[model samples]
Every structure is written in C-alpha cells, then in structure tokens.
Target: MNSSDSLKLVVKQQNLEDISHYIYAIVYPIVFLLGIVGNLLSSLLFSVTKLNRTSCGVYFLLLAVFDTIALIGGLHHCLNIGYRVAIPNATYCRARVFLVYVSMDMTSWMIVAISVDRYLKVKYPITARIYATQKLAMIVSSIIMIIFIVKNVHLATVFIGDFSSNAADNCDANPLYPKYVAFFHNVWPWIDLTTYALFPFLIVTICNAFIIHDQYKRRVKLRKRNLDRSLITLLLVSSISLILCNLPITILAGVYTHISTSTNTND
Candidate 1:
C-alpha cells in the first residue's frame, strides 16, 4: 500500500482502539459496582443465613469469593486500557495474570460442582443425601482450587512485562521458554476452551437436562410443585446466562486460534 493509505489505516486502527478504551473506561466501573454489590449480598445471604447449611450454598459462597477476586483482577485491565496505567514489571504481570486465571478457573468449575450437586439431589435424593454434604462440598471446592492453582502456576514464571509503552497489552510469555511459548500459542487456547467453556458447558447442560426431565416427570406424576423450585430456577438462569455470555467470546477465541495456527503452519 502507498504511504497515504498506510497512514490512513494506522489512524483508523488508532481511532478504533481509542473508542474501545473509552468504552472500557465507562463499562468496567459499572460492571465492577454491580458485581461487587450482587456478590456481597450473595455472600451475606449464603454465609449468615440458613442457606449456608446446604452443599449448594457452600459452592455459592466459594463462587462469590472467587468471582469477586476475578472482578478485582479485571481492574488491572481497566487501569491499563482506560487510564494508560501500564503494568510496572514482570512480577506484577505474573501475579496479576496468575490470580486472574486461578480465580476464573475456580468460578467456572464451581458452577460445574453446583450443577452436579443439583443433579444428584434431583435424580437420587437418597444417594445425594449421603454424598452431597457440606463437608463434601468443602472438599470438592478445595480440590478444584488446588487443581487450578497448580495448573496455572506457570503463569507466575511465564509472563514478562513489556515496558515499551503505556499500552494495555503489556504481558508476554518469556521467550526463554520456547516450549511454553509454543504451548501458550498453539495449545493453551484449546486447553482454555475445554476448561473455561466446553467441558463445563457440556457437564452443566447434561446435568441440567437430566434434572429438568426428572422434575417434569415428577410434576406430571404427582401434580405438585417442585420442592426445590426456587433453587432450581436460580441454577437454570445462572447456567444459561453463563453459557450465553461466554459463547460469543469462546467462539471468537476458537476462530482466532484456528486462524493463528494456520498462519503459523503456512509460515
């Protein structure tokens, strides 16, 4: 392209980025406020009230805590994009990225745990009574935390801060670890797809489907309202909303990954 055309293209891209930054500046505070308020109320209801007595409630409490953490992690992005506050160094980048991943993984898997709990409680009341105890919920939540922490620990070492400018895209994988660089580019996207979206989506969808079918049959046979109607409705809404919100981003990431992979192969 000619110099004028290239200059115009650059200016257009810069304009788009500026627009996005302004959008983030506006939207993020609203999300942070709403998320914090909602999660705090949820935490209070689950922890201080009788809701905390159940396994489902235990999962929710943990979800609230982790979701809050995830939201806080997002502040870095807001600061970077909106305020031009660059990540200071490698340590900050690593810690920020690590916390974000761990918290997000916890939130995603916690939903799966809740869905499974609901499934068991619905399909096998007797068996669920035995297995779906608060203690079991604690244990399962702990295991999920431990697993995600271990899985994402490499983030602490892998990412390095780029100090060239006050741009939002600051962290990059350490070039010293070629294997990790390859994994980060070529493999990590799929892993994220499975962990963050696909696996949870499949599990929650299947479990909820079974729960819904069973509930329908029971309602037809007994002609009574579902005992756990409120709780079930809450789970259904959360699961559906989670999937819907994540779907667009998930598909976009998958497409980007595929295109990137093809480009690398052609190179």
Candidate 2:
C-alpha cells in the first residue's frame, strides 16, 4: 500500500481499538460501582452471620475483597483512557500492572478453590468433612496468595514507563530485562492469557463438571439441590464471563501475532 493507504489502514486499526476502549470507558465504571456494592454487602453478610464460621464462607469473604480490588483496577483503566493520565515512572508503571494482575489472579484462582471445595463436599462428603475445614481453607488461601505473589514478583521490575514529554502509548515491559528481547516480547501476552484466563477456566470447568456428576448420582432432593443455588449461579456467571470475555481476545491476539511474525519472516 502507498503512504495514503497506509495512513488509512492505521486510522482504521486505531478506530477498532478505540471503539472497544470507548465502550469500556463508559461501561466499566458502572460495572465497578455495581461490583463494589454487591461485594460489600456480601462481605458484611458473610462476616457477621453464621456463614463466617464455615470454610466456604471464608472463601466467599476473600473473594469479595479481591473482587473489589480488581474493580479498582478497572476504574484506573477508565481514568487512563478518558483523561490521558500518563505513567510517570517505572515504579508507577510496574505497580499498576502488578496491582491489576495480582488481585485478578487471586480472584480467579480463589474461585477455583471455591469450586473444588463444593465439588469435594458433594462428591466425597466424608473426606470433605475431614479435610475441608475452615482452617484448611484459610491455609490453602494463604498458600495460594503467597505462591501467586512470588510467581509474579518479576512483574514489578518488568514494566517501563514513558519518559517522553508527549507520550501517547501506555506502559510496556522493559526490553532490556531479557537477553532475548524478541522472545520476551513474543511471549509476554501468554502470561495473562494462561494465568488469568485459561487456567482458571479449566479449573472451574473441571471441578463443576465433577460436582454436577456427583449430584446426579446421588438421590438429591429438589430442596437440597436448590440450597446452593445462589452460590452456584454466581460461580457460573463469573466463570462463564471470564472465559468468554478473555478467550476471544486471547485467540485474536495469538492469531495476530502469528500473522505478524510470518510477514516479518517473509520480508
């Protein structure tokens, strides 16, 4: 394509990207507010009521905390897009990415924990009673949080800020950190895809599948089946939303990367 054609193409691509950003700028704040209210109420209920004494209730309580945090990340995203709040330094850039990823990661894996807790309760009641105590849940959650933070600690040093006076782009990873800069750039996107989206989806899907199977085998009463309806609905909605929302973006990103690589190779 000629220069004019190239400029048009660039404009078209920006339009596509900005369209989604625009929608998110408007929609994310609403979602953030609603999430804050819902999670706060849940936190209050789970804390004060008899629910706080149980293993599952503790998970819900923790989930509420993490969900609120993740929503804060969403709010910052809107502000960045709408107001052009530039990343001032490396620490700021790294901290922003770290905050969003840590909370979101914790939230996603905690859902899996909750899923497995329910599955074990249904599939092996005796074992669940023996093992799935409030103490165990607390221990597992602590372990998960520790492991997640350690695993992602590199993130704080990875992001580089825009020092330019008229910067237009968001923060990005520091290319100098990796010996093979090209390889690092190529693989960075997969981190969020796998950790935040893919693994969580798989964990939730597998646990719920077994839970449903176990429920089917037992002579479960109508009332008994409906007892955990609200929790189940929340799980279903969250899991499905995470998978559906992230999966398409992940696949498109992968495809785009592949095409770009092929074009570069040919050139």
Candidate 3:
C-alpha cells in the first residue's frame, strides 16, 4: 500500500480498537461488578440479619431487589456490546430496554419511599407507627412496582436494529426513531435524578436535621450528652450513605446526556 493508504488503514484500526476497549475493558466490567456486589450485599445483610428486620429494613430489602434487577439489565447490555452479540432480534431489545427503565424507576421510587418513611418516623412518631408498618411498606413497594411497570411497558414495543451493515455484529435501535432515544437517554434521566437524587436528598437532609435538632434539645434539657452522641452518629451515617450513592448517579446521568447529545450533533 502507498503511504496515504497505510495512514488511512491505521486510522481505521485505531478507531476499531477504541470501540473495543470501551465496550470490554471500561464500561462492562465496572457496571457489572458494582451492581452485583452492592445489591447482593444489601440483600444478604437484610435477609440474614435479625437486626435488619425493622420497618426501614423492609425498604432496604425492596431497594436491593430493584437494584439487582437494574444491574442485571445493565450487565446484559454491557455483555452484548462487549461480545459483539447480534442481540438476536427486536424482541430481546425491547424486553431489555423495558427491564432497564422499569428497574431504574422502581429503585428511585423505593428510595423515595424510604425517605418518606424516615421523615415520618422522625417528624411524627405517632403517624409513623400507623403508616410505616412492615406490611404498609410492602404494600407501598408493590404499588410502586406496578406503577413503574405500567408506565414503562411502552418500551417493550419499541424495536431496535443494527444500522451498520458493515458491522453485522453491532446492535442498537435505529436512530430514525429518535423519540425512543430521546426518552431513554434524555427525559428519563431527569425524572430519575429528580425522584432518586434531588427529592430524596432533600427529604433525608430535612428529616435528619430535625432529628439532630431534637436530639440536641433533649440532650440539653436532660444533660445527657453521652446518649445523644450515639444516636447522632447513626443518623449521620445513614444520611451520608444515601446522599453519597445518589449524588454521583444523578450527576453522571446529566454528564452522560450532555456527552451523548454532543456526539449525536457531531454525527
């Protein structure tokens, strides 16, 4: 080959290598491991430990289940990409998309439910007793699941296909159907962030703030500093974890959207 021909071949080879590395080395394994480990630990801890059978434990358990499902859906996509699987046909694509969104929706709402439960328990103990029973928590979780399923089932009807005939292996929805892409990548992330990250953060912060304030007042009135410290520590840890897990996901979703849109525009 001539020099110019060799240079063109080199560029094409590098591009192919970049795509391969992204699918196999970066995206797939990170998402798979994190999802499995995080959700499994949450599930096992809640299932085996008697201490995890509280009203809050019910919420955590449900959250763990949804997280696992979401992670599975995510991992499936990652694996398909890494392996250059054809993804069979549109039926699998639709089902995978539906599962991904539904599980995500359920996870967000479960976090919301947990936040509300915590708020009630801290702010109105009597009301919390009536409203936040384990049975009640289960019922609420069931309703959330139903709502998410009904709302996102439309995804199962949307078909994806490989547009690149040159790469018989690549699989994705046709960009001609921009609506699905818009909904999946753009609209849904905002909704998820709002419900999962922003609202939950606010609820947890307010609830914990009040709890700490009340504890401080009680400690001052009763002169019991030692007793208050332990309670404060527990509440702080819970609040911090909730915030930490949620904030990155929300921020990353936005960043991902921006990057996706920019790339699409360039294309």
Quick one: best lDDT, which candidate?
A: 1
Residue-pair clash count for candidate 1: 0
* Model 1 poorest ten-residue lDDT run: 258-267
lDDT of 3 by residue, 150-189 (tens): 8766667643543343212233445667777666566766
CA lDDT scores, all candidates in order:
0.76, 0.70, 0.67
Candidate 2 lDDT by residue in tens digits, 101-214: 678778888788888888888788898989898889899999999988886676676535333423323444445545534444576568768987899899888887676556
Clashing residue pairs for model 1: none
Clash pairs detected, candidate 3: none
Name the TM-score of candidate 2: 0.79
Better of 2 and 3 by lDDT: 2
Residue ranges of candidate 3 with Cα displaced over 4 Å: 1-38, 48-53, 80-88, 159-186, 224-244, 247-267
lDDT of 1 by residue, 8-99 (tens): 98777567556746755898889998999999999999999998989999999999999999899888767765665655577777888789
Give per-model TM-scores: 0.82, 0.79, 0.67
